[model samples]
Target: MRACFSLDTKTEAIPLVPLTPDTLASWLEAHPPRVRAWVEANGFKGKPNSLCTLPDEHGRIQGVLVGLDTEAPVWSVAGAARKLCPGTYRLDTDQDVAWLTQACIGWGLGAYRFDRYKSAEKPAPVLQLPEAVDADEVLQVVDATALVRDLVNTPAQDMMPEHLAEAARMLADAHGAVFSTVEGEALLSENFPCIHAVGRASSHAPRKVELNWGEDHHPRITLVGKGVCFDSGGLDIKPSNGMRQMKKDMGGAAHVLGLAKMIMAARLPVRLRVLIGAVENAISGDAFRPGDVLTSRKGLSIEIENTDAEGRLVLCDLLTEACEGEHKPDLLVDYATLTGAARVAVGTEIAATFTEDAPLYGELEEAATRLGDPVWRLPLHKPYRSSLESSVADIANCSSAPYGGAISAALFLQEFVDPQVPWVHFDVMAFNNRGRPGRPKGGEAMGLRAMFEVIRARFGG
Candidate 1:
């Protein structure tokens, strides 16, 4: 269901049925005889999000009576609007007029139906916003969120490494950014050994796309996304069920690209550089196997304990390259659907963040709370460095022990990062298993908004 705020739109006033012990007394003073009778008969003791559709003598639907708890969060209105009949609805009171915009977004999010494979039974309800709310901001947020959802929902066949490069290219074209890509054997020649190793098995050649924009002198912000188009778990193959949703393995890249689009479109003043190490971890004769030793762009030799843990390998090279050029960004942030350990630590709802800089984490944490996009900061414990220690290579890509796998994974990435520079690594669960207000149950953007807010705050627009 979609909501639009316009006086021109057809809408009916919805009185919030108050929660009181004396329902009859509350009804007698506030509502008409018909409404009072209905409230008494139906036992409509006002409860949060409770709704009662008022009817006429002829039993036809007249209007809606909804209940609210004033103390609750604004998001409590989520999914409640969809329960009402499909039509334009307006608030009966003027005091909370500002809530109209937030409610509109909530209702719009509540009505999202990813009915790509099936049809929705009920039509979406429309909510009208009051004139005070900013319509343009609402539309912009919806557009960017829809972009994220659409990219995440698309299957791997349609969103492979090359296809992801096309997406990056399209965004570059839109903003007049300079776009360049390194593909196939060029990766080997260009020192992207890890990227080439992970993607060489796929029929479609993997590509690392780089897009740069804004004035060179501005505070630089580099975004690195792990774009594993489809992860088949390589030589260490996953079971059928485990590989079912591998299409969303590139959720991180999709989010970075989507956020970049929003930032560029909004004209945020940072010198932005977007790097996507797009690849497919597929199995073939040339697939890098378990126990294989590979050298990264940073010259760190990695022993592949499990080929499934290849996302970090791709990111390591891209990050190394991001730091190589003369115009290196002051801040580097990388997003990835990196490890199952992240989901285990914080679950699918929250993104796991790791950074050595406390101020960066504090700012990010505060921004996340403000934006309502939650992210939990995981530690980069120095002692966990032993978990990834390798007897043969410089380090093992996967840890020897399973405990603190998420921290070890972050520590693994820490090996490649410039210790002097500020960096935040996000292990994001890009998919939503259960639908929530403003979040649909499909491929979703987890930390995009929080990161954007932090970026904008650090380097003002």
Candidate 2:
């Protein structure tokens, strides 16, 4: 909800020069001897995200040099924003509107810091809005991204189910959208049995929060988020290290809320429905245990093979509800920090995306490539569904197989989704283990921009 950029019409803003390995030598050769000498002395070889400051005859800052990979991510300029001295800077190179937009976004993102709890914090270096960039669009992406980061960065103590619902309520209020919730025992009356079951043990009551906006005649877009506020792994329980960052277990909910904010802020033509099953998988006398049979809103009984696989249970009932009613959504997208197997398969930075729609997947791939958000496609292998087969229940919440955990998880959710509808599942690592140029070491929004692009293209603003 805070501004990410400051527009400056002044011509005296400091220049930021982006240089690739090939271009660095030539650019340095063109500069003054002292400037070139200082850069070489500092070991500035134009490596991606590397920076060097040029000084004038009076040792005053003249300009900044940012090293870039020829195929560097759009956020390459982020390092300069983060490391540079506080000053108003502008991109000095020639680039298209898209490139400028991405650069601005990178700068804005790098400027982010979660100082909500800190007593004192330094301000980020300022970036002047580029001339050709669409200010509104850039700000929308940055604000939504910041929202995701802020929500995910907050510890579970302050980010419980009630807090998550309050955040959704604020978003709905801001957009003049319809907001509703089925909390606690009401979840049972509403037939959200899986949601109720998974969340019943937590002192903070679990609920399904929904926000609806846009015209009724417009294309419908439904976004489902697995909002497991904290996962102590239920009665089965998680080890100490495993439970440490469980606060981010609700990354999926943060993602959808962030995406919803973007769509509504952009005033896209599509009617949007955002549903979050806010819950905490806490250990207690009432916590649902392994082997417990839970019936979903769709009447499918799920045998809980592992209480840690609680995200899918929260999502199943929400997805079932989304597919119902007069008009089905033209597109349904769900985000979850569902499986560590996905992180093992593609590492932490890349989101493991699963969708049956080839054409939609193609569009998403292109958008990811162009936008510099990375998402790797994994099969929703139907054969893996056998891994989830249970003799007593309609399905098992987890696979018996050790491998293909991500696939099995996708397949499990696929049961609740209608094949005719376009559905995408993003099993993302919402936390960055290490800091990168624009992405910090805390909560990161994976695949958000790429998914936003797909939605934007499908139903134009």
Candidate 3:
């Protein structure tokens, strides 16, 4: 919860000039001879995301030049944060509110490092809060993002169902929200049989963690997250490579927690309900197996075609529970690291989004485009619903066919949701496979900002 930026207490400006390839030569001519010589000597040709530091006459830090693309994205300024020496820095040029806000966010993201278990850690260079940016808004985004990263980065041994529940409890306690859980046999008694079945094998008990906040008069929004703490693919079993980073399987739960923190911290005018189905899919004699039929909370029977498809099983029960209240939520959003097919279709950078409601999808799309958080829409094809047909149960956990796996997964989940409620499901990667200027190579928060923007736009922020 540390602040990424502070007020510029000093009067001196450590000029940060963003230059593009086309304008590099002309801009270089305006600088002093020594600065120009340094730029040439170092071969600083203003390539996008490249940085060069200039020195004063006494060999002290003077200013910095950052390379940018012609149509530079807001995060282009992140290069300065990554490359700069440990000291206070400021933007030399005046920018609009949106640009400044994004630049600040990018700077914070670039400066982030997961050193929780490290023996030593290095401090990052600080950027002064620009006058154009809203400090609270930027900090909220940064803190929420950091929370997601921290939770996902943790090893499975440390981030079990109980640990995730405790995290939810802490967040709820911090915001004065009501927090509760249904654990072990309590889940079965509560009619969350599918959730209980998937998690019953692991030593760490499976549970549903719920957090409710905001006034009764406010608009209702419910968030459901699939919390597979560690997926060893259950009895079906995943390949060794597939199970390597299975610790991040709980990323969906982490994401919802992060988003919940943001909404509560911003004090958005909406009644928020967060439900996380926390469990670990492990090997044991009691592990749920393929061909097993489990009755869901919604009273729908699902035949397990593959135990590896456990995320949907957990989410279906949670979704059913979320929609059953006296007054249904105005909007129901769920996040899950549901399918490898989503990754195959869109890769890791874009979240594969599926929603039946057009208006809600439009809002999400617009928010993502505006915030530079990418989400690609994949169909919940009605025809694919037939692919999930089972001999005994109402539906199969996975499709009989291999193609359009992501679409089929969405269709399977759509069965649990009410047709009337506006719902959006994000199949997120929740990790940056390759590090970029601002995004590091580790557990990441995908679609979080865009989703938050949609909620803010719908309800008062």
Candidate 4:
């Protein structure tokens, strides 16, 4: 099933019903005796994500009942979508609009498949838009998420700096936006020295892309993403297993591109600018070595403590250019698969956010909870800022301290951000290690929905 919907695209689909522990009794009462008997015989008692297929007198599927865990409806919906037989279906539900919307989105998400390299993918269950659900809204989120998954799941060979730039350009063109990129030696001439330094080792030179959309009069929103296409850890090389998933290091770029797609599709009343620094952190004779000092576009000198921590190197220049450059934003947000420390703190499933703006963080957190997309806000912890201090440069790319690595990393990036600009940073484990009902074990769009929710609420189209 494609993850897209429109009001005109109606379906003569089968029924997929949802039941919760609290409402199962009433639901059973309204159904026919045969249906109730079938449900009872199968021990369908509305347990979380449990299912039963009700048959008619002729022994054909009359309807399918799925149990719901109200607190996390996405899981329940995903369970149904994944387990159901391949057929066209529509929600036969009486839940409120909020619950139904979640169901539609979950159904779409569950049906997702990243079979780009395969000759053919398995047929998936198809879903019709549930009543009272906004098809456009659901499509916006699902399409954006699919883009993230596709980009991040691809290997580094096909998704290098230029390839990432092409993806951005396509997205920009599709949305009627202006797209531009500064690549290779131009990165150095453009004063994006730190970006140049990290990506210069590889044949595919580092590049930065900028996309602008919406009218000038609207609220200005700037998004910066760290696009390290592949990280070989430079001279501070990672162990074997550690180097395996480095292809997903550019997940932050995938995230921002997906987020930007949502913004433009929703036509939110905001002037949006997306800045992504795409580079490959490969090791060679010319790799940027540890202890080297590099100057960012903001002109702040940074000491490279460890080349493995290269996400921030690319981002510092982008963040500086986003915050202080022309077309400055009213609100600035950045995404990077920056630290293992964040994954340690929140686990791989839930993404972590760092922002000095407490209220902004609170708003995004609340929206995330409501949408079943888990997110957390870690501290910009000023006390830990001292750990990044350097004797030779203004700051170090990483800290020597063993603990609080996530906080210190955030502190490092904060050096380039304009404090006055409302800034938020996301540190995500963009790849999912475990396969859940809807969320497969590949690239995931962490916190993308929650951030979109806040932006939409603040600046409606």
Winning candidate number (lDDT)? 2
**lDDT, candidate 2, 277-304, per-residue tens:** 9999987888898899998999998999
What CA root-mean-square deviation does each model show from the true structure?
Answer: 3.4, 1.3, 1.5, 1.8
Q: lDDT per residue, candidate 4, 1-461, as tens digits?
A: 36323243465666777787778889889878877787889999898778888877787777888888778766667867678777777778767888778878887787778887988855667777765787788888889999999999999999999999999999999999999999999988899998899999999989989999999999999999989999889999999999999899999999999999999999888999999999999988999998899988888889989999999989999888887756678899889999999999999999899987888888998999988889998888899999998999999999998999999999888888877899989999998999886798999999999999999888885
**Cα shift from native, residue 340, model 4 (Å):** 0.2
**Which residue pairs clash in candidate 3?**
none
Per-residue error for 380 in candidate 3, Å, reads 0.9
- TM-scores for the candidates: 0.88, 0.97, 0.97, 0.96
Query: What TM-score does structure 3 among the candidates reach?
Result: 0.97
The predicted structure with the larger lDDT, 1 or 3, is 3
lDDT of each: 0.79, 0.90, 0.88, 0.87
Angstrom error at residue 298, model 2: 0.5
Q: Could you give the candidate ranking by TM-score, starting with the highest?
A: 2, 3, 4, 1
Q: How much lDDT does candidate 1 score?
A: 0.79
Q: Give the lDDT ranking, best first.
A: 2, 3, 4, 1
Which segments of model 1 are wrong by more than 4 Å?
Answer: 1-29, 36-50, 55-74, 91-100, 115-123
Global lDDT of model 3 = 0.88
> How many clashing pairs per prediction, in order?
2, 0, 0, 0
